[model samples]
Target: MIQYFRFLIISLLFVSCTDETATAEFAKGADVSWLPQMEATGYEFKDEEGNKADVLQLLKDRGMNSVRLRVFVNPSSDPRSGHCSQEETVDLALRAKEMGMDVMINFHYSDSWADPGKQHKPEAWEDLSFKELKEKVYEHTFEVVSAVKAGGVTPKWVQVGNEIPGGMLWPEGSTDNWDQLGQLLNAGYEATKAVDDNIQVIIHVDEGDNNEKFVHFYDNASEQQVKYDIIGLSYYPYWVEKDYTETIDNLAFNLKDMVKRYDKDVMIVEVGGLYDQVENTKNLLEATIKAVRDVPDNRGLGVMYWEPQGEKSWSGYSLSAWQEDGTPSPALDAFKN
Candidate 1:
């Protein structure tokens, strides 16, 4: 009887795949990049008195099953925006996990924002030698991920860097330095693996529909020995001058073609339809939801509307506009497929 019980346990373990494999099925997930704000006191969506809504419940109610969170290596010197600190991120992750949501970690590898136009090096990393910088990257990544895991919320997926086409960590690891870039990313991968081998390492890059640039960027990464599981894309219709239907169609075609060609699963890690009369945010959301549901060959894995509920107005980092009473407009209806 004991032997039979042991066999049953082994079978269960063998059949149950890791979170990475399970999520690869849908490529379906949401990036909850606003946890820092939601946890703050007296914070209301768009500063509306009644906007104290539970975002996680709302997303789950709408059929979202996973959440992605971005971690800045050291965020800004400012105190308020400094909340992506290890303690803050882990706290948010724990809450999400308790609510029965899967999580993904996006490593920006900078103290502040890291993107295509600006991938600045951390202040501390500015003086490090090449070898020292590599070591620091690995150490920092391991510590952050280890803290998240220790906090009882294990992320199934991790992005090495954000929208890094020109490369991240500046000068040394910047675009023209493929050798340095490859070394830096490998360090991040090792850090993630040290936490859990099952975690999927994602190499995220922007410019989804632009076949020429995407292909070129990825081919370069491949040659550099940057090991990763998922290829993440950031698609914004406004940037490409395409309508909602046209954008989704283009995304679907590219996704299917890329998967077939690269033999790698794809995730729209950062995607948003600006609700503020830009890119027809409303129409784009509707189309995106439909696209996700009817994604051809299951390749349209996941689409995360970037910071839909962030502070409104063009003056701040937030997207979207507000009504006189601070009511969030219908731009968010894009998620309601």
Candidate 2:
């Protein structure tokens, strides 16, 4: 009985710490999952003084208090499109934590990019039966999560699957089959909690400005008994080819609506603007951060820039916040406040 009471006290303390973190920190950072690969290729990051610097430290100095890292199964070596294996992600998470930054682990459940457009299962998972698929989901999630903790950093949040509004693991776990999707999601959720109930689970989707998308997905997820602690979103104005001014209002409204309707904290887990439009991007980020901070009860968790350190020259991706000269763009200063 004494041991049981002692355990209960520790458990409650852990839960309390998790809640305090959500209310205390407004997560502001980038999904710099490609940092390891970029550094391996000899790309250097510079501070404002043009002196070589560690990008993580530069981001922290700019007011970022968190980092989001994505994990893949057996991945390819492509710097832009592949190689976020568990080991790589765990290492990155350790680095971020060592720098006093909170970490979010994103499970893509695929060997490549998994988004609203496509969610291909990893090659090893493709042929499994539905039952086997769910087990794999749990197993994979558990392993990576346990590994991250063992590496000395417990991720504050774990996204069950990336941009999964249409569902993940393909036909068996697609939106067309919400029941199956829910089960698969719960498998990931359960796995996450099995590692540590203190870790919050996130369900991510794209098109943050589209309220209909949120309603359609979350409504169905609710009916299907999908369990989650947070709603994660990806908002990229450059991808939509529109100036952020056009949809910033909608995004703000959606943020409030999701919190009220679902009673869950919400986060702009991924967002970015064109590297060339630094001023406009800065404005967009400032507005985005304000919108989140304005949410009642602070249910609006935070906003994270996707790949802000990914230089366009090296990534061939134009939406990063890094300048061509290898310095971080002023746009990142939005987090300065």
Candidate 3:
């Protein structure tokens, strides 16, 4: 596989491609679905009378080709409290499919949010050793995928774990323990393949524009023999503490190199900017679109505005704003080419 920075220069040489040539290569996708917590806070897919809401139709209408839903095995709190169980997610997935949108399942492998800072295993698997954990991961993954399939919705992509920068499932398979992490990832990969070899498996990480982190994570995963089909990144200019343009440029360049080196398709599975700051939001969104559009050919699979219209907005984690009666923000229009 191609290592990012080492081959950066070579990628720079072929960066200039005509728009027609670029579009013919990499198509676009989105990760519009929020996690369980966000969903429960008031982002209802069903109306008070139990009818389908227009959000699904709106996404399809707005040109979003895909919706990425996160699945949590189980949670200490109520399952619906921002941590999606198999049932809720599948229901959502089926709806997305019905709306003619592709779906991607992101297995957080934890009961709550799993990112660079935290990864808390579900209570049920907290005691498992490496081997037991691997088997458990496979069993859990298979069950989730199976549930989605049985519900009459097939996912186009499945992420093995969500932002596994410091490892997943905790203790035994944490990032510091590469051997365990490799086994953990493989468990999910195996399940995905068993269910359907065609569903692309993604290994996701945060800090999309950070070349060093991207290089380190991918290289370590390669050394551990972790299998994945897509390079998934989470990019948010508002959250990232850096000059937005430089960060985006670094990310675009890194993505091109990652595709060239890893031989995998790239997806900005999770991305968003603030809508409250109207001017800044517009600028940030434009920069983001340009960065994604800049990637060579099929390598840049485009981005999803992560919960752009989430309830109450990004200021708080509530789902109130996405309700039908709620006014849509200018953020939605930012993605238009």
**Candidate that scores best on TM-score:** 2
Clash tally, candidates in order: 6, 0, 11
* lDDT at residue 180 of model 1 (Cα atoms): 95
User: Which residue pairs show collisions in model 2?
Assistant: none
Off by over 4 Å in 1: 1-29, 38-41, 46-51, 77-82, 289-297, 313-337
Q: Higher lDDT: candidate 2 or 3?
A: 2
lDDT of 2 by residue, 207-286 (tens): 99999999999999999889899999889877777888999998999999999999999999999888998899999999
Give lDDT per model, in order. 0.72, 0.93, 0.73
Give the higher-lDDT candidate: 1 or 3.
3
The candidate with the higher lDDT, 1 or 2, is: 2
Q: Compare candidates 2 and 3 on TM-score and give the better one.
A: 2
TM-score of each: 0.83, 0.93, 0.82
Ten-residue stretch with the least lDDT total in model 2: 21-30
What would the per-residue lDDT of candidate 1 be over residues 1-337, giving only the tens digit for each residue? Answer: 9999999998888777654465554533466665465445444443235554676765555556678888876666353344476777788888889878888888887877788988888787889899999999899889888999999988888889999988989889887999899999999999999999998888888867777777888788888978888788888876766665666777666676677767777778877655557447666666665555464565556777665545444224333323334445555544544
